[model samples]
Target: MSHDARVFLREFLRDPARVAAVAPSGRRLSQVLAGAVPRRGVALELGPGTGAVTDHIRHREPRRHLAVEVNPRLARLVARQWPDVEVVCADAAELGPVLDAWGAARVDAVVSSLPWALMPEAQQRTIMTAVQAALTDDGCFTTYAYVHALWMPPARRLPRLLRTAFTHVAVSPVVWANVPPAVVYRARAPRRDVRAD
Candidate 1:
């Protein structure tokens, strides 16, 4: 196994609920997710496991890059690997405050590797609410769902939740290269009035 995969496995073994996947995201999926970041603009990444997507995001060369990781070990690893990125070991649900504390009133893009399918509805709403609040008027938010779990309740509920949060939500075609396959959801024009309730 590659170094990243090994680390991902270890993290997943330690906290299956948080680390969700047994391996890091594939290059193709990472590229698709990172593509949402606007060049030279501020970018925020949630749950950058083993820096797979982070590697691609850095190539976009955003003026500022901030990553929020709930796992301390993974956060430290990502920080060490990507020195330029601002790594914060905290819950993604606190995205609003994290951005506020970082002095980034709004970010141009949000690339998330968070496992929304594994999250409870309330948790999903909480994080999505914070994401909407942290994005700029034209900012884009990109996240993905495994194809195999599309019929699952949490995954099925995601689109409805996203539609309520953002004015535009576009689903990508299946990325078969990824383990278990997945589809990206790119959302824009966050509805300012939407709140987690």
Candidate 2:
């Protein structure tokens, strides 16, 4: 297994709630998430465990790439591996200040691997609100949901939350190559003046 997979596994074992994936994201899913970004401005990545998606973000050559990981070990590893990347060990909901510290008010793309299925509705709303607020008007937020979990109440409710927050939301075809088969959800930030709060 790759080092990233090993590190991700270690972190997942440490706290499954924090790192909810069964395994590190595969190359295909990473490609899809990274490519979903329409432009190359400040890109914010949430839950970049082991840098699986971070590599692809760098490959896309965004103007500035920032990753926030709740896992301290994973955050350290990402910073060590990608010395230039701004890797912060914090919650995704702190996006606004994190961006401000970097002299950025908006991000063009947000690639997240957060375990939305595992979070409570209130927590999900808080993070989603932060994500919506952090994005630029034309920004896109790309995240995936496990195919098998679609029937779950939280999974079903995810769309409703997104629709309430964004101007458009698109679901990509299932990526069978991923360990547990997943589909990407790409949401366009609302064009109207809106505050997620």
lDDT of 1 by residue, 81-182 (tens): 999999999999888788889999889999999999999998999999988888899999999999998999999999999999999999999999999699
Which window of 10 residues has the lowest lDDT sum in candidate 2?
188-197
Per-candidate TM equals: 0.98, 0.94
The count of residue-pair clashes in candidate 2 stands at 0
lDDT of 1: 0.93
Question: All predictions: root-mean-square deviation over Cα?
Answer: 0.9, 1.5
Runs in model 2 deviating more than 4 A are 191-197
